[model samples]
Target chain A: MKLLTYFFQWLMSLLWVVALQAQAQPTQPYSYPPSEVVRIHSKILNEERKVYVHCPKVDSADGNKRFPVVYVLDGDNHFELLAQYIDYLSRPDVLAIPKIIVIGISNTKRTRDLTPTNSLLNYEGKPDSSSYQGSGGNEHFLQFMATELMPMIDKNYKTAPYKIFAGHSFGGLSSLNCLLTHPDLFDAYIAVSPSLWWDKEYLLKMTDEKLKHGSALNKMLFFSDGNEGGRNSFFHKSLVKLEATLAKKKLKRLDYRYKHYPTETHMTEPVVAYFDALRFIFKDWEKQR
Target chain B: MKLLTYFFQWLMSLLWVVALQAQAQPTQPYSYPPSEVVRIHSKILNEERKVYVHCPKVDSADGNKRFPVVYVLDGDNHFELLAQYIDYLSRPDVLAIPKIIVIGISNTKRTRDLTPTNSLLNYEGKPDSSSYQGSGGNEHFLQFMATELMPMIDKNYKTAPYKIFAGHSFGGLSSLNCLLTHPDLFDAYIAVSPSLWWDKEYLLKMTDEKLKHGSALNKMLFFSDGNEGGRNSFFHKSLVKLEATLAKKKLKRLDYRYKHYPTETHMTEPVVAYFDALRFIFKDWEKQR
Candidate 1:
């Protein structure tokens, strides 16, 4: 009986020591791709805007090197995802793309700033005044990006001349809008599931008007759609029309690709589309290197 | 001159205020999915092990709910990526998959812990002594996982009975090895580019011997190969053989998928294969609900 009690006591002490060691072992937060939030007061918008900036970890030898930037809209939704892709693709082992900076712009007035024309029509072609109350500010938004945001980013960071604009849904519409209105603002454009039905296809008509046949518009573009409604849906039809229009124009140096994901839904489409878009943009990049 | 001086002073004051405001605007680290590192002393492996744990954010309504677990090998390389995918896929907005816990097992001894046999020959059939010094301790490692790690996770976190084992490359070989040797260890297995050429195709032969024709092995498996070598390469050929063997077996209730990504390299394959595997495993999930 005495031996049994002694064995029990020994076991208890061992358990206590093991527990203490487990607690004492050093642990740290799972560090993700290093990213930061920067705040800037925008004069054009008359509001404070916050953006998430993710830059690749620089080598000591390449501290002064500049990197191309990808300005992503819907920052709150897709910044970290883009950041993760950028980091992984540009890793030492996987040199699929060059190390680039990702600037994610968060929204204060998403609808107002993303829509090209003021209209209250919902996706079902019905009036939705509550959701579309303060629309048609995308032009001003572009001006702010071109003049204020771009200049600020260039001045503060080691930025290269090359830049890419990326967005999804309404944000995607804005990206295409920027390409048409302010072509020199970015070198590449990604519009995933863009709301081409916005204001009765305002951006689609704008694309036709702005991009001329045989015009020397050197840029890369990737646009895609998932199963928002299906093949006959306005979403899919608009994408097909956009593709056809671009092909008909045969504009010089406008490299573009359109992908359709039938299995994915609208919200889950960006997860795959963004990765594909990045791969498309950088497809020729590895060969050039 | 007096008016100019006054205007200059006003402009200077405004600039100073703007600078101060920029400095004062609250900035915080980009918050990632909350994750933690756990240290465990494994008596089976006779060493300490570190695992990464990433759980979905618990809603107030789901305080007592349990989650399925995915145990991923190569914690250092792919944990963050999988965590990101799970968080995005299981979001309230994007209900592509259910919320689950991810356990990433970090490697202490890579070759010994991951390989199934003691072999000095690499993919090229060349003897590499240093690299294969301590090969073939995977059985003990799996024991550590089943006896030590899973129990600890179950005791600490709200875990469901459904479990998945995921790995890549050599880790992928171990995943297949576990499936063939200890079929009841996990409900699902994901082997992304398993090095089937290991020990002159030991696991491939083991699969032939262990799994009987039309056997009732109720499990899900996803395996794939990327551009490790071209289509005619041994890597691709071995995958073809494995698929043929499985097909010939006609194992009952063993849901399996084989994907080939010709565009992606061996290293880059995991990025796409994992997403596809998750989708495949949960393909019928929505309809069941």
Candidate 2:
């Protein structure tokens, strides 16, 4: 009887301790919509490339439905922000945009893969050798993406034909490079604070060269610059020049929007710029739906 | 010898199948900064309430650093976004705002807790009994937050003295209600598109009565309205009236901002409003830091 009493006491004490622990420590991690970190072997790059992908939650109604893909550069910096925006925008209540499969391509040798020229000349036309060494591999990088990454993603995910190419800074430079060099690669493009000053206005010159006057380039483009180097700075001037060049083109079907966030800093611009870009890209999405 | 040969062949085929499966499958879930879902037993509300808490990642430098807490309503809709925003804004590279804790208070009987009054009248002043039944428990809800939720949170977490209260729509109404009734409860308040037409603008009248004219109300208030109900909307009118009332008071030490997102829809307004509010609230954060 005494042993039985002791056992009950012991059990009661154990339960009490558990209750205290529960009170002290909140249980369970807050659940976020699930996303995956995917790795695919790229033969063109000759190395494994990692990408962050976030797909919409599939329900019974969307059993066989496919989604558009938003392939963003600088995955580590901007992937989650894009994913969060997409999720919120596509919520049943919000419905600002359709559900999307976000593909965030993280970098390997950022300058090398993102820059269009092998020149060591910096934004200021100074030969910053250490920074610009082995800088011209963007063509090869895009080739790897076109031949390897896209095919792998298309094969594995429930993807529609529509795709968006998005990037910031050097990544932004690469985005414009991709669009000009291979216009058919993506249906839409977003370049937030592109380093247009790269290699003595290489992209700005390329923009003027590649795009034709009165020609049709059917795609949605969102290009933006913040108060990066200020109003009179070359960075801002380069953006203005790019805008003027595009205006000069008068392309027949190129739906593009250029936003100047005078209030936002360069690092902070992507947050608002990405949101504005998505909204611009899908301005008539609801009406169409 | 024949049995050994058969086993070797079987092993080789199994290895090949494994390799194929590995190629097909992309392993691992994308990691997000961790957040906790805390279920605290609430005596005031007489129910177990669940709140989502996200703290900044503490490092060796922050061995015992306490952080400010932001208590936001509509947890299910906005918690993760706030968490994502705080995390990004406080990043070393993008130090727009200081690192802070985010607490997302989800709803249980939202109308009961968020509305300032029990009237069944809709925004159009028609009785909407079914939609608004069991309304006007906001005072009790605030009581629950102040006496129960905040105390419990303060006890469990490493919290600083400062706190921010944020909400949208009806939740926005509740936020304004809290600011007026319990000004000491939080250091700052954010109301994103507050439903000012509630109970024939009960809180708007309260705003006039509660705040003393030309008196010091040393707090940060951010209130905004989207293009809700359109240009000539009563909703927009009410917001304008609220702004006018505050202007009329000319209250001392009241740091406030009123934003009108003419391009944003009622639903889509919160995303930009919340971001803008955070930026507004911490506009001089970098300078101070």
Candidate closest to the true structure, highest TM-score:
2
Off by over 4 Å in 2: A1-25, B1-24
**How well does each candidate superpose onto the true structure, as a TM-score?**
0.90, 0.92
Per-residue lDDT tens digits of candidate 1, residues A34-65? Answer: 68888888999999999999988899867689
lDDT to native, each model: 0.91, 0.91
Question: lDDT at B241 for candidate 2?
Answer: 96
Model 1 regions more than 4 Å off: A1-27, B1-27
- DockQ, every prediction: 0.27, 0.40
TM-score of chain B of each: 0.91, 0.91
- In model 2, the clashing pairs are none
Query: On a 0 to 100 scale, what is the lDDT of residue A288 in model 1?
Result: 88
How accurate locally is residue B263 in candidate 1, as Cα lDDT from 0 to 100? 88
In candidate 2, residue B80 scores what lDDT?
Answer: 89
Q: Chain A TM-scores, one per candidate?
A: 0.90, 0.91
For candidate 2 chain B, which ten residues in a row score worst on lDDT?
B1-10
The Cα RMSD of model 1 versus the native structure comes to: 9.8
